[model samples]
Target: MSAAAVPAPLPLSYDDVVKNLEDLPSLPAVVMELLNSIDQEDVDISVLAKKVSNDQALTAKTLRLANSSLYGLQIKVTTIQQAITYLGFQTTRNLITAAAVTGCFAEGRCRGFDHRAFWRHSIATAACAKVLARQMRFNQDYAFTAGLLHDIGRLVLVASFPERYEQALAYRAEHDCFMLDAERAVLGIDHVEAGMALAEHWNFSDTMRLAIGGHHDPEKPGAGFLAAIIHVADAVVHALDLAQAPDGLVPPVSPVAWNALGLDEAVYLQLFRETELQYEEITMALLS
Candidate 1:
């Protein structure tokens, strides 16, 4: 049903939801261990690889990703250690995070949620963000993760309160508005707030927190470069119609985010093309 004649979504307070949001799509422990392992000194790649390989599903996905054109490895690596040896530790960690996050969600109960489309958009945005970061000599892994999970709060809401999220989706379709607007209108909290709460819940790093929490608000006092990068990546992805969102709503680009890129129009055209290429390879690898 279209949003036009839809009844208002049942009310739910953002605070109350956040307070009880502990059970939303828990990340596998391997991700947390890997993240925690990175912060310590003299960490052995073997140990880290073992942690990831322990989960057979995660290992297979991670291996497939390491071989994707997105990683562009020279030789076919058969195992996780070989992957770490060639791609380096940070890239390996990024691979695991991508696999784990993508694997966490069930088929959410929201009937029209378009789970496949949502991930396609997320992967496209992540690819776009990585291109931006590489050109800027910034952290590609952080940008990739942020863009990959930028809309995670929406996933959390869909998983936890499918009926309410369905209402927000209807509202978005009816009004032909941005998802954030429809979400706030119906759910009383948008994904940004929900994402920040989730990020904190998962003990995300500062860059991650900025990416998830400030992607839509890059002008926030401490939003930082990653936030702006994610913001621009998200806009570029949607503007290119990568999301295939029925409403076709592109979020307004923050001027601060847009101007920070300092790239020429020609560069953006290249980025758009490059993003689509990597997205096709990577999404196939991850989602297949």
Candidate 2:
């Protein structure tokens, strides 16, 4: 049978969808406290580094990242202070947030769900967001955080409702529909909506909430600039096959977003190339 001939998905209600959202592990309290401290203009880097060092895994990751070539460091960073000094306060804090949230999703076996591939896609999308933010002269720090956490709701859904999520994925394939559309058709809401809800629940900034919520639909004027960047970044990542997911789609860029960002075709192409190169270095830094 043709793909279009597949049956429509049965709808599930939001209430019926058991939100194990509360049970999902949150960012470590110390990490959250450090993030709050870093936001302060008078943040004490020495104190922050000492706190980070207490978490053995986070400390190692920070040291490895600090020593990575992504930062172009000439000397090895053997200590937390050195890592903090070398990476800078803002970048170090961002990395800590990224690291803390990386394991929010559970790794499970699904017919076509490639865990590594999903992470690669996510990282590439994040890289694209960061680069695009610089190109468009937006808030790079906020963009990076948004890019990294945009799809967090998908992880929540998969972990919280595996059978239903699997069915939604199957429905997407069977109907040749976009994953987001399929998610909404099968469940009461899509990942973007769920992600927004979760972000709000976590007390994320309005910028973050909008970016994650409107990433798939940048034309929505309510989301402002960050949403537009994430939308384009998501499309670029998919088009470049950075992650090579079996069901990934190369979505179209919103002309409205392009115009608002003041980007022409040439500028977009140039940014894409730069983002691809940066993805390699950033991925290595984070994954190392």
Candidate 3:
């Protein structure tokens, strides 16, 4: 028997999608507070630690992650302050955001999305981005956070339109096409827009918004450097089949991004090696 052809995807209301994003669920108060604190002219660690400390569960998780093998700390961290000191202000902020975002999707309602595998891929990509940033002498902490939330829009889509997104996933699986194509074909909008909308709603930095929105297609003139890093890191992860559902298409690396980074083969090999070595520990620490 011949294979059955897939039908066209249903059209979506672009306005409603934007509205849905406008009303997307707000992050926990502490997370929001922390996010705001990092943006201030002068961030006080004591105050930041107090904010985290107020949330007992988050404090504990933060401390545990600080002491986890992923960080390779010599002395155990018993409090949020110690964690802040050891992990550095930006790193601590990244950890808190990672915890908060992971908790946001704790109860995954998306039918086809594998939450655990999805996170595994995210953390691994984060690790890859961080290592790459350090090797290239960029801001490692920011790179890590950007990598972690690179696919936030996909999660948002799954959360808002579970059934439709599931069909999109199914279509991608059947045809072996990229998720971006599948989503655009099925849902009339892709995660990039969804994620960018969410980022804007959340008051994320312009750079972060750019990274989330342009990681897949950084072709526009004057694309953000961080977005370019995320673009390459995302492709590397997919190429290695690190995610639960890696994108079917490994989009070509942007010449502008590649030439700008000026990374050699040795760096790429080292990134893969470091990502492999730290993937499990970092994933465990963050996801546990």
Candidate 4:
């Protein structure tokens, strides 16, 4: 008999993806507040600190990370309010965001997707992006959060359609191709499409939404530097092998994105060292 034809994935639009987005776990109210306030400098840090302190689990992780050598603090941070007092609002906000985002998803049931590896890679990207931003005089906070969430569309797709995502993973392995190709083939949609949808629904900033939508094509028109930063950060994280998944495939960096940073060899080395040092502490605090 002739080989059976593959069934076509049902037609999926942003609306379809948006409707399924409701099924994914919601971010805590405090996290939502923090994310929306990222661009506003005059936001009440004191109130936000109180809100973070109210969540026992989030508070524990934030303080643990703040007390870790990541900050090299002389004194221990016992509460979110104190952590903010010591680490400043941006750092405290980052810690809370990290804790909340990680806590939102437990282990997933996608057979081919490795959840632990995913978060590790994501954290590594965030660390790498922070290094890049610091070196290049950019906004480290946005860079870090954008890097951390660059692939969140993958999570949304898997969470909303586990079986189809598993098939995409299987297709990826069988063809030894990029996940995006497999996702398009198997699901009729890619994570960028799904992720951009979710970002919009959640009222994330336009820059962040563009980073999600254009990370794979950073050189494209309107991608801007944030997307470029995320793209390069992702490439660096994969090259570092922090995730250490046997099946990991490092995607190529856009030359435009790489050249835009204009970093010399010494700066690259510093970034590698700092990212490696920072990634472990963040992982243990948030992923543990």
> RMSD in angstroms, all models?
3.6, 4.4, 3.7, 2.2
> TM-score winner among the candidates?
1
Q: Give lDDT tens digits, candidate 4, residues 179-265.
A: 888988888889999989888877788988998888899999999899988898888888889989655688988899999988899
Candidate 4 deviant stretches above 4 angstroms? 1-7, 40-42
lDDT of 1 by residue, 1-288 (tens): 656786755666667667767767677887887766656778877877887787899999989998998878889988889998999888888888998899888884898899989899999999999999998899898899899999998888888888888988998888888899988898888888888888888888877888798899999899899999999999999999876867577889998788888889999999999998998888988899
Candidate 3 has its poorest 10 consecutive residues by lDDT at 242-251
lDDT of each: 0.86, 0.74, 0.79, 0.86
Best by lDDT: 1
Q: Rank the candidates by lDDT, best first.
A: 1, 4, 3, 2
For every model shown, the clashing-pair count is 0, 0, 0, 0
Q: Estimate the overall C-alpha local distance difference test score of candidate 4.
A: 0.86
1-288 per-residue lDDT for model 3 (tens digits): 988999865677656567786455677786776776766877667876787788776776677667766678999988878887887877787788887787676455877788887788788888888888887788888888899999888888888889999999998998888888899888998888888778877778777888887788776765688888898888788777766564546667878777778889988998898887778777767677
Collision pairs in model 3: none
Clashing pairs in 4: none
Local distance difference test, candidate 3: 0.79
User: What does the lDDT read for residue 158 in candidate 2?
Assistant: 73
State TM-scores per candidate: 0.93, 0.86, 0.90, 0.93
